[model samples]
Target chain A: MMIKLETKSLREAYGLCLVELGKRNKNVVVLEADLGKSTRTVLFKEAFPDRFFEMGIAEQNMASTAAGFALAGKIPFYNSFAVFASGRAFDQIRNSICIPKLKVRICGSSCGLSDFGDGKTHQSVEDVAILRAIPNMTILSPADAVETVMMMEAMLDVDGPVYIRINRNDLPIVTPENEPYKIGKIWELRKGKDIAVFATGYMVKKALEAAEELSREGIEVRVLNVSTIKPLDTKAVISHSKGVKGIVTVEEHSVIGGLGSAIAEALRKEAHPPIEFIGIQDKFGTSAKNYEELLEAYGLTSKAIADAVRGMAGR
Target chain B: MEAEKVKELKKVALKLRSNVLEMVGVGKAGHLGGSSSLAEITAVLYFHKMRLNPKDPKDPKRDRFLLSKGHAVLIQYAALVELGYFPREELKKVKTLEGLLQGHPDMKTPGIEAVTGSLGQGLSIANGMALALRLEKNPARVYVIMGDGELSEGQLWEAAMASANFKVDNLVGIVDYNRIQATGPIKEVFDTGDIPAKWKSFGWHVIEIDGHDIPQIAKALDEAETVKGKPTVIIAHTVKGKGFSFAENSAAYHNAALTEELYKQAQEELRKQGELL
Candidate 1:
């Protein structure tokens, strides 16, 4: 199944979505912690200056304030870099937002290794891990611009707390522009019987590419895009894993407590074949000159994913 | 405030203390010292200061109250039951499985504004409510009661700075300055020296008051409404475990399961205090 690949950055998609939300809902407000320009929340700020809040580098304050706004009958979209949003304000998000199940949207921009040149401090490989530990938090990791926009559209109707992670650079559009978005539902892009590559975020596109490359060698890779990391589409993951010779999980995050770990946990009781995880090993990342170099250095490339799948498939 | 009103408020405060004691006994493991410290301030707000209707807890025009130091939620639970937010029977089932109340302030419990248990989070929430109220053009105000030791949490200072920067004049933060925390004195655990000056420097209208003094608590709240262009922080110098002699200023009672004998002693203390009031 071929889909037209449009080129649009996730950050740009986020900015446009905010403007769309601004026009549609008066109760929607956006808050940022002094990185609005980099995070692309400046678009929302310009359109809804009255509703936009510049929290000035205070991520923790932004989180609780968003919680407060939720209490006062307003849906708040609080934005920050992934590390700051998830790591710095974990307590606030956990206590104020998750515990109460407030209607707040926390978007962590430049997640994973997307902020490639900035080194490990800005990269948030553990954002999902930390947030997953908190109860009542729905984690949504959009694969591309289309999914990001759709996720933003879906956030308005989400009654509980949500964290939507976005990438910094342009990721090839994998999901169709007209594809209906559903939280915790897997999007199966390719059909195969030999192996299933469960991937998330930017790695979804990589998985698709790896599957395409593996088609030459007749590996018959089944690609599953695990968008909503938490409230994970476990049924989809398990059902697709049935009868497959092997399963390979790919992500731009730590293999310790990420999508790989979540899938492994879900499949623990069920009888399944061996699985291989292709992500950053348990090690700190250094400042990379480019994202491509970072991906290659971390073994987070299509070749590496294909290599893992080949090993899983015994070929 | 009139003398009769002050006397009546003190009587209500004593009743609230009794209610806290009863609730804590039911919950088995609850913050006795911290909850007792805020009884008078909580009583003053619910009975005399904040405009609230128990029947309409979600009233748009009603004032909002948030217990920032949420571990000390037993007293707030007491006041809520008295105000008819929930039936009195619910109070007896606190801390039990499937109970209406939990150890901390949860929105699941009626009349709770924000669910706060982790420290340094309530002020930012109050600031959010203040901004929302101002945006909606509602005349309602927000009241947040925090613990003294909770001030050491960096997020509170962030909220304090943001509140001042945003001019959240409709928000009033009352620090239950009981000095004593779970381990020991706040000065010993993590000293935030010069509490009033810290709040003042954060651009809040700082007011020092005897938090246990019902009339003075009422007066500080009244003064909060008159302040313009900034939020107000009432550094309420309260005694930890006020009205309960054995528990007063004792960190052991901060979050203790009262023995049957201690519970009886607490009831007697409240009984004697009620007579004095």
Candidate 2:
């Protein structure tokens, strides 16, 4: 089977989806912390001027204000860089939003070392781990642009707090456009019998590519898209690992308390194969000229994943 | 303000003080200083100024009051008990695992609009509610009370800038200017100089009044409602423990366990105040 090579920007898709959500629901409001242009929420600001709140550079205030909006029967989507959204305003999100369980959607754009030029200060490789520790928080990591739009639509129907991690660059469209996205469900992008590869966000595309590479070497590899990082689909994880030689977990984040840790915790009690984690190995990202350079430096490429699978297959 | 209404509100404030003592009990630690300081303001807002329904706490068109200085929640709980938001018996069970009330403001409580206790976040929540009400064309208003010492948090200034920038006229902020914190006085700790001047420069309609005076609190609230194009901040000058003889102006009583003698003495002071009224 041949895979399409088309690509689209997740940030641009998020902006367009906010405009559509605003039109569908009058109570849909957007809050930005002076990163509207970078996060693409300026599109929503242009469309619904009355509903858009420019909160300056104050992420803590923006978070609590979103809680207030939710209290008054409005669906608010607050945007900022992943580091500022999850790290700088963690307390506000914990006490004001998650503790009370308000209907506030937090969008952390340029997540997981995607903002390559800004270095460690702007990049967020631990957002999922930090947010997952808090109760009543639903974490969403869309595989591509199509899934970003679908997740935003699904967030409106969710009752409690949600944090959606979006990448900076245009990613290959991996998910189907017509299928409705569910909150705690995993999608199998490719199937095999020898090894199972669990991936999320930008890594899903890399996982698919790696599976195709392994297919040529007579080694079958299965690829699963674990989009919902929190409240993970453990049953699917366990069942997919069945009859496989080993499992490989991939993400654009740290190996600690992320998709890898989530899977490891899930299978600790159940009967499963050995697992290998592929991510930032507890190290800060450095300033790079481009995204591919950073991915290569961090060993987050199709070749690296294929090598891991081949090692698991004992080749 | 009518003299009869003033008398009635004063009685409500006195009752709130009595309720605070009951909630604190004789041995357990509670925020007596801040709770006592907010009694009159809480009474005036819940009984006279804000539009609310105890039976239907989630009414879409009702006014909102958030305790940004949530350690003073005993006074709000006292007012809520009187208004029948919860049972009066629950006052004795505050800060207990089986009770509806917690040490901080939680949404689990029937009348709490936001979960607060970590200081300096309530004003922003009030601003959000104000913005939402304006967009929906709802005539309801939002009120938040902050501690003077809570001004030490940088997030409070961030929220102040946001409320002004958004022109949230439907929101009103009150600072319990007791000038004392957990450790010591505001001047010795973190002094926010010239309170009214600070808020006025931030684009809020500034109002200063004696927090214990019922008529003054009522008049300031009425004045805040008429202001447009900006939010209002009423800096209510107050003593830390206004009603009690031993606890007045004392930071030691801020969150101390009352002795059996002090408990009886607090009740006696309230009784004498009631007789004078």
Worst 10 residues of 2 chain A by lDDT: A1-10
Model 1 lDDT per residue over A109-185, tens place = 99998898889889988888899989888998999888887777777887799998989998788887666676778
Model 1, stretches more than 4 Å misplaced?
A: A1-7, B259-261
Task: Please provide, for model 2 over B175-210, each residue's C-alpha lDDT reduced to its tens digit, 9 standing for 90 to 100.
Answer: 999999988898987787888898999888999999
Looking at candidate 1, what is the lDDT of residue A57?
Answer: 82
Cα distance off (Å), candidate 1, residue A219: 2.0
Alpha carbon deviation, residue A5, candidate 2 (Å): 15
Lowest lDDT sum, 10 consecutive residues, model 1 chain B, at B21-30
lDDT of 2 at B209: 97
Query: Whose lDDT is greatest here?
Result: 2
